[model samples]
Target: MAAEQGKVDPMHQFAIEPLFGSAHWEIAGYNIAFTNSALWMAIATVALWIFVAGGMKRELVPGRWQMAVESFTGFIDDLLEANVGKAGRKYVPYIFSLFMFILFANLLGLIPLPLALAGVHPFTFTSHFTVTGVLAILSFAIVLVVGFWKHKLHFFSLFVPHGTPLVMIPLIFMIELVSFMIRPFSLGLRLFVAMMAGHVLLEVLSSFVIDGLNAGATFGLIVSLPSFLLMIGICALEILVAGIQAYVFALLTSLYINDAENLH
Candidate 1:
């Protein structure tokens, strides 16, 4: 094991350890307990609330905080309107919350605090498939609910394009149906993999930096310097990726909702 050998384990960051005692609340043979992942998620949710609440002051002439929030709101509004048209206005609240939650969660994970000295480290819940999968399923469920509620059985027609020959109907329907079903998995996997990969890379580089320094000054100069610099660059890239992933998830969710809203 990397840890036993006095080396950093890149994968150790992803471990889901309980925050409380070792004993977990079990129901039907499954352990359910508060964890670092849950703690970070709760923190992100609270942070989002504070951010949005500060902006809700409703100044006659908006301040910087209000302006920042308005800018994000407008961005999502425009995205929804472009994809789903006027009806999208009603869904703005849901979509906006979703986007902000994800954005905050992603950003929070990258915060380098001194908590490690207190035996705490920031946890990125989005890197976990369980977290991402639940978010994806929630979005997908909304699409299904809205589609069925609004269009009833006609929603099934979404799998069939506007134009297709009778001979190709079966093949096209199966293909489209399969693609449709894969959306949730793809959406969740995208965020999970992106977050996980970035953190793993950072951890590995951090190990190199530590090991190189401990080995010798020459090795440190040769390996640690370059790795440290690359880590900085990668950290910057990861921040951008965090934002982009949130936007992509929101955009794709909006697009999927468009299909439910307009049968596109």
Candidate 2:
């Protein structure tokens, strides 16, 4: 149902609205003010800075904070080494950066801010294609540049697997080429859709429970209880999804780099 008459709109949370007063910034009569999405992005960037920098101190005896940071970093390091091998260690910092930024962006969206704030800026910019797409493009660029830089013409061999019959080579190359070209889209879409869907599901479920309670019937209250519990479960699952999506993105990046560097 449309939210025009005060109905719940799960998607309204994803809208892009002006960050400040209207008419403050415009071009040719079109309002182009800074958006909440932009503000959240800036916030995420600042948060990343504070967390990473603050946790960089090397303590003689690591405190809980220090240990937590070290553990997270070690996990990222292991992910890189597992997917991309020893040479991949060189890209650890970059991979770790990608993972943490995405992980935080996903988690931030789960925060239940005021309805007014959420309507203007949900703070889960990663749920938007533009943000995720940019990251995907960056990953694609790294793979492309590294592929060509390391292998020259041999990089094209990535589109052709080994141990293939001569007759099937042409068909296989086309399939691989198409898959390779759309990596960025797939990478970004996976995260963007997953984040958006999880949030929307939670909102829709919560609305159902609220509507049930408002019905003023004993059965409504009982029904709402189960729905409420389900909503809580979904929230927990989204938290897990947030981490998994970030890991998949980073792992895919590492695998792409590996393929580019060590192509068959």
Which candidate has the highest lDDT of all? Answer: 1
lDDT (Cα atoms) of all candidates against the true structure:
0.92, 0.85
Clashing pairs in 2: none
Worst 10 residues of 2 by lDDT: 113-122
Name the lDDT of candidate 1. Answer: 0.92
> Each model's TM-score?
0.95, 0.90
Model 2 clash tally, residue pairs: 0
Q: In candidate 1, what are the lDDT values of residues 1-264, reduced to their tens digit?
A: 677998999999888888777457788989877888889999999999999898998998999999999999999999999999998998899889888888898998987647766777889999999999999999999999999999999998998898889999999999999999999999999999999999999999999999999999999999999999999999999999999999999999999999999997
Candidate 2, residue 38: lDDT? 74
Q: How close is candidate 1 to the true structure, as a TM-score?
A: 0.95
